[model samples]
Target: MERASRSNMQSILDYTDKDVRELHEQALENLREIGLVNPVDAFKALSAKDSKGRNTTLLEIREIYVSPNVGTEDRELSRIITLYPEITIEGGGQYSQLVLTFENNRFPDMNRIWQILESYGKESAEYRENIDDYPMLQLTILPLTLDGRYGFVMSSPIMWFLTPADPAEEQPRQIRMLIEPGGLQFVQDESYSVEKILEESRKMMASYKMDLQRQLDKEEAEKEMQREMEAEHKRFLESNVTNHTFGYDENTARTAENRRQAWNDMQKDGKFKVGNKRD
Candidate 1:
């Protein structure tokens, strides 16, 4: 009896070993036979052809036009909305706006003010992932230059929610939170003028906005297509149902129904349109 038990254990181990080995072999074959596909030609070029470590494709992107500064009286400086860089703040909390100010207590030259602003601007951590953090507002440059120093400020309104409760009353609704009198700072440099800096900033801001808009448009189109596919799937499931004697699987029917509903929704939204405009 002991011998028989030992033989059974050995057989189990052998079978397990063979199955694992076969799975590994199959995975390896799949990897080698299926070459990786680069989603973009630029990525492929970067890995296989571009030797200079430069984004040649990205450099070709068109920039937005900058308008000349018509001065302070002509324009109003209102609070613009800016999203926090990270999804959550450092303490596991969420923030709607963060004020980033540049101070100029060091430099005291008037002519070199623009130069200083440009230098500090370059170092500012205004860039957020995917460029849609402040969809409603654009980053603008300030010109307050004096005594060889210049000032640049970034201002944005914040949005957040607060809930209040009274057992007998409804909970407080969401409110728009804002950070007023946004932060500003001064930098010292004489290389560029305040007008030029502001122009550059506006141009950059416009370009970022355009890119974000295009990306959103593309995503919307993809979502519409997915809805259409789901609708078609639902149709198939409903048409292929079995009677009580040969009952259909509830799980399968539910899945197919979901897919079909998605497709139908997409059709109703008119999401699947191929056009030269997209091109």
Candidate 2:
């Protein structure tokens, strides 16, 4: 019966925007009417209003932003954002600007949802290759998973802004993979359920890191070796020139002279400086 319930819940995860919005509205309504302040900061923070007069509390929504390079486009990003919740960064409220999530775990606190949001924003900045921009959107809960397996998830249409697709003729590009570690970063060997996947991913990442280090070391060694060889060759030439000793037997010297004469004869005439002397 429990398993069936879980299955049913999973099936409802893709509820349409209207469906999710209704549920989110219900949750907010419950919170407002009940005056529940268990997580007081988050309760108040979520109630903030923006210039347009719509905020998370009023609309009961979350907003997810896509790559700015893609611009505001629903068709360009809807599939990517909705399909890959595991690796997506989530944010909400006033502290929303400073948190990031991997799984449901926030670096600072896990029990508190508001702390989790702040942590998600912080982590996003921490892990991002570029910190100049905050890319996470305001995400609210309904179909959202608080399972600690994802940093954040959206439950309704009101919870996110629809990314507008460009009208330009160019076809949108598809993401090959979620390069960011995302929730996978939080898995530890101790978690019995997630241990196997976590361990394997760790091993693979370790191997790749080691291979990269080895390649860098090899390149450095090769460069050093080349430098040494060059120095040795230069030294050898210098030593030979300085010593000015042709370590040749009488026969070898005679042969060298004969070749020299042959080369001299090949030229139409000799062009020599006035003070030039031949040994």
Expressed as tens digits, the lDDT of each residue in 103-133 for candidate 2 is 2222111122233234445546575545333
Please write out the lDDT profile of model 1 over residues 18-84, one tens digit for every residue. Answer: 4434433433343345344222221222112112221111101111222344342222322211111
TM-scores of all predicted structures: 0.27, 0.24
Angstrom error at residue 112, model 1 = 31
Name the weakest run of 10 consecutive residues (lDDT summed) in model 1: 82-91
After superposing candidate 1 on the true structure, give the runs of residues whose Cα lies further than 4 Å from its correct spot.
Answer: 1-149, 152-186, 241-279
Residue 90 of model 1: what lDDT? 14
Instruction: For candidate 1, give the lDDT of residue 62.
Output: 18
Q: Tell me the number of clashing residue pairs for each predicted model.
A: 22, 29
- Give the distance in Å from residue 271's predicted Cα in candidate 1 to where it truly belongs: 26
